[model samples]
Target: MIEARRLHILRAVADHGTVTSAAAALYLTPSAVSQQLSALEQETGHRLVERSARGVRLTPAGEILLSHTHVVLAQLERAEAELAAYSSGASGTVTVTSFATGIGLVVAPALAVLADTAAGIRVRVRDAEGDASLPMVLDRQTDIAVAVEYRGAPGADDPRLTRVPLYAEPFDAVLPLAHPLAAAPRVPLSDLSGDTWIGPFPGNPCHDVVVLACEHAGFQPTLEHLSDDFRAVVALASAGVGVALVPRSALRGMDLTDVVVRPVDGIAPTRRVFAAVRCGAEEHPLIRPVLDALGKVAG
Candidate 1:
């Protein structure tokens, strides 16, 4: 019989393209991962991995096994979910992961709601970006992830996870109070073509959103300052450093004293936030209440 844990390790290796990366994702050491892979090969009587100077590649048999691994893992999750539903009250902890602003905007508020209503349930939160959260959910490190949609994110129907839509928020142009465009009811991104921009660092999803929006507006933004913190990005704009485009939700509760935020006139760039769970665990007793609370807060 093939051990599900070894199959999980194989899937991780395939997903990340390296045993070392898979180990990191699984919170195991490289040697441990290698040992598990070797054991799995002995059990299956198949060569599943090809090692080269560059890295490891999956053999055709490995690819086939990986496909089955996904289905088996999801089914196991379903069995666990069903068993949890039968066992007792929804009275355990649920681990959640989200980006920084999402913690403030959605997850925190949902925690309050859950505390008032489902006091038996507790939540532990981790601050992670969209890129990291989905994998965490798949690995069962997080029960649910409040993640944003980025270019490479899995689609809504991905078999490995289930995505529940929370909100779609637009990016607002933030300008210094003294800037001429600050007074406009709506700012065209093209109008800021010549202005210096403050934005998130490259490789961040928000950074890509801003860059793609600017490219659509006919010019690449001159990014003079980069920060992952939306609050810092807005603060920099307030200090007359440069203009910025920040998600509307991120601006909540911030003191915009010297900043002017206006909607973009055309093709407003927006980020879609959602909750993701392992494919078959969306309705797990402990997870369902939290997902409901988050949906309520998002609404």
Candidate 2:
């Protein structure tokens, strides 16, 4: 069966005339968008697109599929609009799971907004890591999960859940105050290649983030000390043992006494945070308001 999500991707390519442009509009990598288009072609057993030096154009098969894609997407939107109206007066609880920083940064403030403006909605917040929270949403343990992009996260086209992007935060380099480059306005990640590293353990999501960041800087980090808690990581750096890459959000609660924070030179590694709900629940009246509130504060 053809996935509706792929149809949307097809429509994006058709409208934009190139894979790169479509990927940008969809907030996806160009490679990911191409993979989806390829899967779409395989499912239909026809070549859907013709790529050339200038850009891309649809083949006859692609044209036919795109024509129907419009009708299908329109119907889906209509269905969502009607459902929104049906649940217009909805009043109930929205249970949410998020990491500690997420709870402090967005969730709690959003709850305050709901108390005043969305009296019909009541939100219950729980502290859960992003990896654990995603499964909780799938198992129906929570209505929503504030999650970070991770190694095994559900793809954008996953049918069981709806992904709403929240924001992306960068990882900053933390070094001992007495380190040679500690006072530099922005530290090159590669500059710390020779330094011992302090970071989260292997299974933690932050661990993958740190590893990826270091790899992007052209070298692997030598994790001399390990701690998942950002505070502990910073404390280790402050103790002048090693350096670490900590997310900007996690650093908010740190005591920074003998440590210096610097942005990574060139591009910093970033993690994308998003909200996930069971498929079709995003439009629910009560849940929609909370998502809106979250967006407002996340801004």
Candidate 3:
């Protein structure tokens, strides 16, 4: 029932020993200070001060309230100091979830960046695919989600999320080194119509992209191998099990001795990467820098 601001006024009067002195200390008019003191007394239903021409003094009731006010004011000061630290993004923890490749490409590098720059921020990372991660952000399970664009995914205009585009990477064609077209600089999707495909499973965003791209190229792919790992996809292609379209980012730093990676000719099947947070949360001091760091690393 007691207001923090009025408690502050009460503490000031007790400190200054008079309404007029407290008013000067607070930059408030004497009447304004007096009115706030009256309201505080009424709110507590206790005669908090005794006034005389000499000045003002606390009644025993006032003395007790003043004692409590000291502790309350100290706590209020601490809360204000913490709020200012949080508002400036100087210290906090932020949780992030992303698919494996995204973690490697963006989140990992981002952490390194924040370490050197915003050392006060601690980030917790989770590995989750776009389908799983997007919903996590929507439901408040995480502070940020680095995800891929996929079927049934929320659109940019979705009121629940604020999407920040990180990058779009083409799905490079992976072929057996001995395959007939392996030597080509780039291969058209239609040219591989007869080949067995190695791809992510049905529900994956990459799977939808590959299937749609193949359909646009005028044939539905015959997928004979499935795995979410790009390394496995490349291994399968290298062993002559099937050909695949793996994201360029996922291919980073892997040995490709047995398989050849080529760009998809004309209209490549690409994965659009982004970071998402609950609507209006993108401005959070800790979260915003993480997003910016992710974008910087992805770029």
| Local distance difference test, each candidate | 0.91, 0.85, 0.85
> Tens digits of per-residue lDDT for model 2 on 73-147?
656745764676686756778899998878888999989988888988889999988887886775456888998
TM-score of 1: 0.94
- Clash pairs (backbone) in predicted model 3: none
Off by over 4 Å in 3: 1-89
Best by lDDT: 1
Number of the top TM-score candidate: 1
lDDT of candidate 3 over 1-299, digit per residue (tens) = 99878877776677567888778767789999999989989999999999999889989998888777756655654565456556774688889999998888889999999999889999999999999888666445687999999988989986457799999988889999888998899899999999999999998999999999999999999998999988889888889888999998888898899999999899898899999987656666677789889988877
Backbone clashes, candidate 3: 0
Q: Candidate 1: where is the Cα deviation over 4 Å? A: none
- The TM-score of candidate 2 is 0.70
lDDT of 3 at 106: 83
